[model samples]
Structure formats: C-alpha cells, structure tokens
Target: MNRKHFLSSFIAAATVLPTFKTLANTVESESSSFKIPPYLKQGDTIGITSPAGYITLEQIQPAVLQMQSWGFAIKIGDTIGKRDFTYGGTDEERLTDFQKMLDDPNIKAIMCARGGYGFVRIIDRLDFSTFQKNPKWIIGFSDITVLHCHLAKNYGIASIHSKMCNSFPDDWSKAELVQIETILSIKNALIGERMGYTAPAHPNNRQGKADGILVGGNLSIIETLAGSDSDLTTKNKILFIEDTGEYLYSVDRMLWNLKRSGKLKNLKGLIIGGFKVKPDDAGEEFGKTIYDIVSEKVKEYNYPVAFDFPVGHQRNNFALKCGANHTLTVSETGSVLQSF
Candidate 1:
C-alpha cells in the first residue's frame, strides 16, 4: 500500500480507538461507584409503601407490629388499602406516595409493602434527587428488583433484597423473619458477617472462588428490564438470580437472552438462587429443569455457580445487600455466600 493510503488508515484507527477505550472505562467506574446507605437504628422511622401490587391494611398489620416491636417507628403510606385494579393505587397515587417517602427526611428507610407488577409503570416517573442527598435503604425483592437494578445502574446506591410486609409470617418465630430483621438493623451485614446458607450441590454446578459486588434479584425482573435503562451490568460482578412460577421453557428463554445480550459473558461469579418453577402439564414437558436451563446458558463461563441457595419466593428467603461486595465459594461439599 502507498504511504497516503496507510496514513489515512492510521489516522482513522487512532480517532476511533480512544472513544472505545473511554467508553469502557466509564462503564467500569460507574459500576464500582455505589454508595452504601446509612444503617438503621432504634427509633428510626420506617416508611412502608406499595410500589407494585395492591395490599390491604389488614394484611400488613403483622409487619407493622413487627417493626414497632423492633423499636422502629412505622409510617404506612397512603397507597396501602387503596386499589386500582391489580395495583395498590393509580400510577399517580403510587408515585406520589413513593416520592413523599423518598423526600422525607424523617424516614430513614423505605420498605416495600409488596411486589407484583407495577413498579415499572411508575419507576420512570418518580424522581430521586432528594433520595441522593439523604440515602436510605429501599427494601423488598421480586418486583422491587426494578428499583434495585435502577439504583445500582443509575444512582449507585445499595438497597435490600429481602422479604417485605406481605411475606411476614403470621407467627414471627419463622426463621425468615429473623433474617429480615438482622438485615434491617444492619448490625450483621455491616461487619461483613451476613448470614450464610448451605445447599446440596447440583451435578451441573461449577466449582471455584469469586469475589465481587453481589448484584441481582428476581430473574424475571432482570430479564424484563434487559436492554432498558435499568438493565444490570454483570462485568466483574457476582450476579445472583432467582425467580418463581415460570415455565421451564420461559426460564430457558430468559437465560438465553441474558447470554446473548453479553450480560452473562463476563462475570466474577454466578449464584443460582431458588427458581421455584411450575411443573409442566401432563405429558407436555418442556424437557429441561430450571437448573438445566441455567447451567446450559452459563456453560461457557468457568466462574463459580452454586444452585439452590435458599432465596426467592419461599419462607426461607434471606436478605441480600443488593449492591454490596461479597465473596462466593463453590465446591463439591457445598457453596457459601458471605458479604464482604
């Protein structure tokens, strides 16, 4: 090639290379810049609101009393007990209730009353300016995963992924209730000694060690938010996912989407939480279990993958700090997930 042709090619490559490098660096910085919210203490007022499905005041009374018993003042939002079809309230009503709690200085933490299918409707309409100034824990799982991913991707604030008011047992002796309280008080998680669980290993499990900020919640929500502004960044991040009531084929499809989108291509680790899938109809099987679908999708990556880690849609659901760094170890014996 002539000097003139070579010169043109060199100049074009130089101009585009820096732009790609800069973009990669920006994404890395944004993913690692999360700010931990202040931990709750006695006398701290907790605000309960429904960002998704409807909940009756009577249904949440047990949770209210539980918070009170823990010495935290409870302020129930107006959205509760108000119904607009399947949602707790109209979009405007839910947005107003959540906005008030976000802006209120006295409410140290915002607890979701339930998670159904409405947070996405009003998530874009709500503002988080005041929330950034006085960051506090936003708690719940499932539909609340929308908030968890949005906060991590945009605002860089950590939130709680745990049982909400709807999941509080009628009798507090259940182990889940204790796990919920331990996370809220932040005594255990703050010291990096968050409660850990063990489960029998699946044949498809990948054994290894990985440490990165643990970020993920319901698999359905994560898949629903994919390619949107709230999509998660799994690069060098420990991605944990759980779901409930999904068909086997549907689970396979969602995991395929994550793999194709490059979300599962690079990860420090992968945790397969409780899928709680529905059984196929008689003789019309989807031909794969939840574990099979997940393992197949992530087969290319060697990161630690642990199955059935006691999370999602079950009485044993435990609290996970959505944006906090954590260490994961997978082996023949079992797997361990602990906050760092």
Candidate 2:
C-alpha cells in the first residue's frame, strides 16, 4: 500500500515482460529460418542411393559418368542393384545407405537413384540428428518429394526437386536439347549458380508478380503428407506442384485437399507444372481438365498462377531449390521464376 513499494514492483514487472517478449521472438526466428547447404566444388563427392525404387548399378552408370565429367567424385551406395520386390532393397538397407551418406562429411550431396514407392517406409526410422548439424543437398523428384517436404517442414533446409539417375540418357550425344539442358540444371544448382526459368505463356495463367520462399513437389505426395510431420507449410510461399499418371478426378481431389488444408490460401504465387493424367475408364469419365480443377480451387485467391512450368515426370523437369527464396512473375508474354 506504500507508493515506493508499488513503484518498485511496477518497474520489476515491466523489465521482465520485455525480456520474455524478446526471448519469444528469438525462438520464432530460429524455428522458421531456412538453411542452404554448402555448394559443391571440384573434387567434391556426391553419394548416389536408391531410397525409393530399384535400379541396377548399370542403370546409374550414365549418370555417374556424366557427373564425373563435371569434376566431382561419385560414391555409389549399397542399395544400387538391390531389389526387394518393387523397392530398392529391404527398408533397412536403404535407410542405412542413406544414413551413412548423411553422416559422411566428404559426401557433399545425395542423389536418390530413382522414384517409385518407398521413402515413407523409412522416413521415420532414419535419424536426422547428424544431418541437421551437417546439411547436404538432396536431389530427386516424384517419390523423393517425401524427403523434400520432410526437410522443409522439420529443418527448414533446401533440397533439389529434379530428375534422378533413371532419367539420364545412356548416350548424351544423341539426347535432345531439352533433356541436356534439364540435366545440366542439376549441376548448376549443386554448384550454387543462380537459377532462372521461363515457361511459354498459357491462356490459363493469371498475370502478376510476387516474391517468397519456394516450396512444393509432386502433388500426390503432398496430399499424402497432410497432417503428418512432413506436411508442407505454404503460407506466404510460392508453391509449384506436378504429378503424373493420376486420373483427372484424383488430381481434383488432391487440389481440394490442399484448399481445405489452407495450403492454397495465403500463397505468394502458384505454379502448375506438368500433370500426366491417365485416361478415364471406358464408361466413367471425370469431366475436368487440369486447368479447370486448379482454377476452381484457387479462384478466390489474388496471387499469380502459372501453368505448364517445366517440371515433373517429363524430360523437361528442371531442378528446383525447395525452401529457398525466389521471385515469380507471370505476364502475358510468359512466366519467369528466378532463384536468389
């Protein structure tokens, strides 16, 4: 009840409140910070492992030779030439191989050999404690989306969403220009070259410009991860998605899931990449084009939307730096995405 005592207590409370607020802000900043792994240099090593599908060592030779010509060493994992039904090997074998690559400081990057139907089986079992301390580039797409999303959600680490060993041509001399360019993009990303990509204009595009962190991968895999630890957080981010061999209805359903889960809202921009739709069953038709499905889901949002971006299961799939900041511009002429 004394004035001096009351004033002292008020000052003490005010001092403690500001300290608590500062600590809370620091924790939030650390949790959301994005990390880019060290770029590769000449003589650096890249470890190749099959975390998803099976592929023979012979199948990966073309990629090995090509990457070697770029002046980097290659480390083939034990899962190469491994088979366990549709998987690269027993789940344990694949996990151990990938874990070793993560722990090895000499291995500067990891390239998943192919994408089929694994990764999720071993994602929880594999420890990322060492990986968090020593981050490295993880490269692949399709099924490898699981790893990309997991890294983005849990660690704020960047990864490459690109073609794998299976996509490499046996003879580069005879390969198409697009194929060569797309493959070269991977090397460019690893060495930390600034990336810029443009897609031809489409009537479906909504013209605008925005800048934000880029995050997304195969649509189906993203849908599969909803509510899990690996689920993507797309707020204030440019989201680019692609998928293959899904029915039109399925693609629509996945987009709906994204919309319902708040992934489609609060986006800086949206890039719709290649979607190879399976034909409808003879008697049953799901009457909606890919554009229609996407437009309906994103109609209310004001962010830019670009279609036919050069990424996905096709040969034109260029490497993307997930969890990195990028600017996307959609104009009547075309759409350009530039990575910083």
Candidate 3:
C-alpha cells in the first residue's frame, strides 16, 4: 500500500478506537449491580418492627389491620411497645429484633414501624449474611436511609424507601391505598411502571436525560454515612436527596460535605426532593435559600437536575426502589422516574 493511504488508515483507526471505548464504558456503567429482592404475595408475612423510636401497638394497629385486610399477615416485633426513653428499645434489643426478622425465612419483608434517630446506632452491629443469601425487601425512609445505603453499598440489594407502618392510614384513601399495594405486591412491585412527577420549573433546573442506578435518601443520613464503609459511590449514578426541619446553615454545610468530599463530582442525574426546612430565627439570617445552596454546589455538572421531586416527609411522599437501575428524564416541562 502507498504511504499516504497507510497514514490516513491509521488516523481513522485511532479516532474510531476511543469512540468504541467510550461506548463500552457507558454500557458497563449502566449495567446492574443491584438485586431486586423477592416481593410479597398474598398470605406472606411482613415483620413490623420499631428500629428507631418508640411506638405503641395502638398507634400501629390500624396498619396491622390494613395489612391483614390485604391478605398479608403481620409479624409484630418485641420492640413495638417497649420504651427506653426516646427509642423503642436499647441498641442491643433493637438490633436483635431486626436480626431475627432478617433471618426469618417466612418473613417476606420487614417494614419499619417508624423513623426517628436510632438506626445509625445499631446499623453497624447488625448481620446481613443470612439475609443476603435469602434476600427480601427492607422498607422505610428517613433514618432507614442508613439500612438502604448499607444494603445498596454492601449487599447490592434493592429496598423500598417509602411510608412506614406509622404512616399507614386507617381510613385509606383510594390513591394512597393503591400506592401501598403497588410496592408490596410481588409481580407488579418488581416490574410495574412508576408514576412520574410534574415539577414546577425552576431557573436552577438543568435540562437533559440520564440512566443509572438511583441511590440516595434523607440528606442528613447520607451526610453521616459519607467516608464510612457503607458510604455511597455517586459516580455515574443518579442521586436523590431529601431532609426536613434542619436549619438552613446546616443544609448548606451538608451540601458542601457532599461536594468537597467528591461525592457530587460525577453523576447521571440529581433529584432534589421535598425539603421541609425550618424557618430562620428572629435575628439570624442564612442568606441563601435551599435552591441557592444546591445549585451553586452542582453548577459544574451538566447532567439532568430536577427539583421538588415528590418524595420525602410529606403527604405526597412516593415510593422509590433504592439500588434499582432507573431512567431519569428532566426537562423544562417536568421530570419522569422509571425503573428498567
């Protein structure tokens, strides 16, 4: 072959090779490391426990009856009525109850009774070896984000970040009942389509579409887990965060923790959920709003960013499957979240 022909061919191959490599890496990033735990069926037993604060059986009786009405049996944990100050039980007792539920083969899922501030205390002491071998859904939000992150980061098992036993209503509304049933039922829970949110457009919202595993929960819990064994790896993954009642300065501080620690450096997308922040005091001023704090920190990323996602401590809180691969589409019109 002529020298000119050889040089031109070599340049073409060099340019083509990087494009192929980039495509391959993209495919690999989107591949699943997540396990979808077996969903519940009729007559399946759901073990309910208070892994955080104290709650009387009277408070949860409505939910228990509701579950039975839906053809599921409720297994109440010992911690349900026990009180040791603010928590249902001591750390040891709570951990034991949780471990028992985790190892119980008949318990198809474990639903948290409520969320307070005790999960981070016992999270490290609990064993998941047995649960890993026979995986089932672990459900809750708020403080339960600890368990969700632990399971996702260490075991790669998907969990429900939704309303807990305390949130279940006795007089169920049609829409609320449907949401609860959809996440608990076996077939549909694993493969059903997610109801998307139509968020009000914000100037800070970034426009684009992305696909990756969804990993995040309460912003405070996530911040606490940072740099730990169970901390999340946000690279090439979509993150959704929410928190409530925190001071504005603390919220800004947590956002900086995520940014400076390199957790927000790479991502497929970001979803900002309901932040029911506390109002500033009479004389104090935090200066920036929640949107201002977040947008400034994430200004460098070009990935899709959706604000006011309908998940968090609110009446409209929607269920999300942590560790599941999802397609996140954000536009000026709104956003859609779907599992693949």
Candidate 4:
C-alpha cells in the first residue's frame, strides 16, 4: 500500500478514531488530494502555442515583447504562425504542437496565441496523462475557454480565463495593460485577494456563504459542454460566465438550457461580467437585456447572483481561477471574491 494509507492506518489503530472523525478525515484527505500546478517562476520559459485561431507574423512581436518586458523567455510552438484555413494550422498540426509543448519538460507555461474558434473538434484527442501529472498555467479566454474547461474538468489543473495574444490592439491603454498584468499574475499562481469591481446588487439574492471548486467560461461553450464530463457541475461552485456580441435571446436560450438540465440551479454564486452591451448603428435594443434574461432563468434559485464583475470579453477584466477555492462576499458595496 501507499505510504499515506499506511500512515493513516497506523494513526487509526493508535488513536482509536471516532467514526465521524475518521470519515471526515478521510474525506478531507481524499478531496484535498488534487494538486496545484507549479507557480511560474522568473526566467522559466513560456511556450506560445496556437491551439485554435491563426495569428499573423505582424501580430506576434508585441505579445513576445510583452513577455520579454516581464523578464522571461518565450518558446514559440511550431504551428504558432502557420495559417492553414481558419486555424493556425490543420487540426492535426495544432494538436501536435500542443502535445509537443506539454511533452517538453523545459516548457513551464503554455499561452494560447489567440481564441476565435476550432478547439472543440480537437479536445477529445488531447492526451491529458502528462498534463494531469505536471500541471502548468494555460492562459487565454474566449475560444481558449475550451482548453480551460477541458483542463479543469479532466486533469483538475486550474487555468486562467483571460486575455489572448490579439487582445492588445496597437492603440492600447494603461487600463488594458493592468488587466493583462492581473492575468499574468494569476498565471504565476499569485492569487492575492478578493479584487473586483464596485457594483450595485440585484433584487433576488441568495445570501450566506458556501465554497467549492470555481469553474466556468463563455456561456455558449459551457452549454455545449453539458452531458459531457467537462460541464461545470455547480453542486457548490462560484460560476463565472461571460460572452460578447451574442444576441440576448441566444443568451436566454443557452441559460434556459442550463436551467432545464439542472446545471445552474445549485450554484453557490453567479458572476455575470460586463456584457459589452451596445445598440448597433440602427439603434435596436433587441427587446431583451442580458440582465433580464439571467434574472428570468435564475428566478427560482436563491443563490447570491452578482453581475458586473468585469472578468469577461472586455478590457480591464479581473482574472478567475478554475479548480481554486474562493470566498464570495455580496452586499450593498458589491461582491468581492477572494481566492485562497
């Protein structure tokens, strides 16, 4: 038997443990068995792999130099700059490059070059054996949410849902830089405190405290992951969801699906991000607001649902860690989620 088992046995025999205490001890020991990936230390090399969207050579230098400014070396993947159709390369090529990076002992981190689409096709083909054992930070949001959801669900490796390579336009601002830095900070596993926005509250609120594995990403992709093992089960979880340019009814349908399937009913907290809501040049309101849609779907539930956390498809968004434990605070001042 393993040393942990042997020691637990020895302790049980010597101490004559109570039944409830023994069960609690075992549950604690088993549930906490999941591992945290090694924090990114300075000077270690980070690999830039385009697991989804394609990136032009023109788009590469700024992302590279950004990492350089942080005093770390970057190792570009073979398929990073290749443009075979809509992806950085063929599906096979993209998977191969990702596998190569995961296989390399020298690569301490993997950052997606961008996130447009094309990851759901290749998620099942990924070999998570090594990744499960040696977890490293996988960074990016949007289509990159596929990788984040896959890694968090299968390998129990926490990943950041944040900025990608193309997020930084030429006309960048200091606020955007700070947002990206918050992401890179979490990439290094430097989760400090419950840092978030100062927002107002909703009418239907489920107060009190509960904590569990934090998980979520784009609403559409998460809905698609339902029935699959990758779906985030909100038995006790702070579910963070965000999206952009999606019609309000589309959001309503997806949330309705999640509601119908019993996914969003038991959530500990619901974090709605800055929706980037805009009326087009024609000045159409689309008949439904994102807030109304969410409130409608979650009306029956009593969970503390807070909106405007600033962690979705917008600039200056906060970083969130899946598979990490967090405490949620909801009040008139707003909700602040602190990760420990």
> Highest TM-score: which candidate?
2
TM-score of each: 0.86, 0.91, 0.85, 0.81
lDDT of 1 by residue, 38-99 (tens): 67677989999998999999999988988788778999999999999999999999999999
Arrange candidates by TM-score, descending: 2, 1, 3, 4
Where does candidate 2 have its weakest 10-residue lDDT segment?
7-16
Pull out the clashing pairs in model 2.
none
RMSD of each: 13.0, 13.5, 12.3, 10.1
Q: Cα lDDT of all candidates, in order?
A: 0.77, 0.86, 0.77, 0.66
lDDT of each residue in 217-306, candidate 2, tens digit only: 999999999988778888888999999999999999999999999989999999999999999999889888999999999999999999
lDDT of 4 by residue, 237-256 (tens): 77888888776767878889
Consecutive 10-residue window with the lowest summed lDDT within model 1: 7-16
Clashes of 2: 0
Best-matching candidate per lDDT: 2
lDDT of 3: 0.77
Q: What's the candidate order when arranged by decreasing lDDT?
A: 2, 1, 3, 4
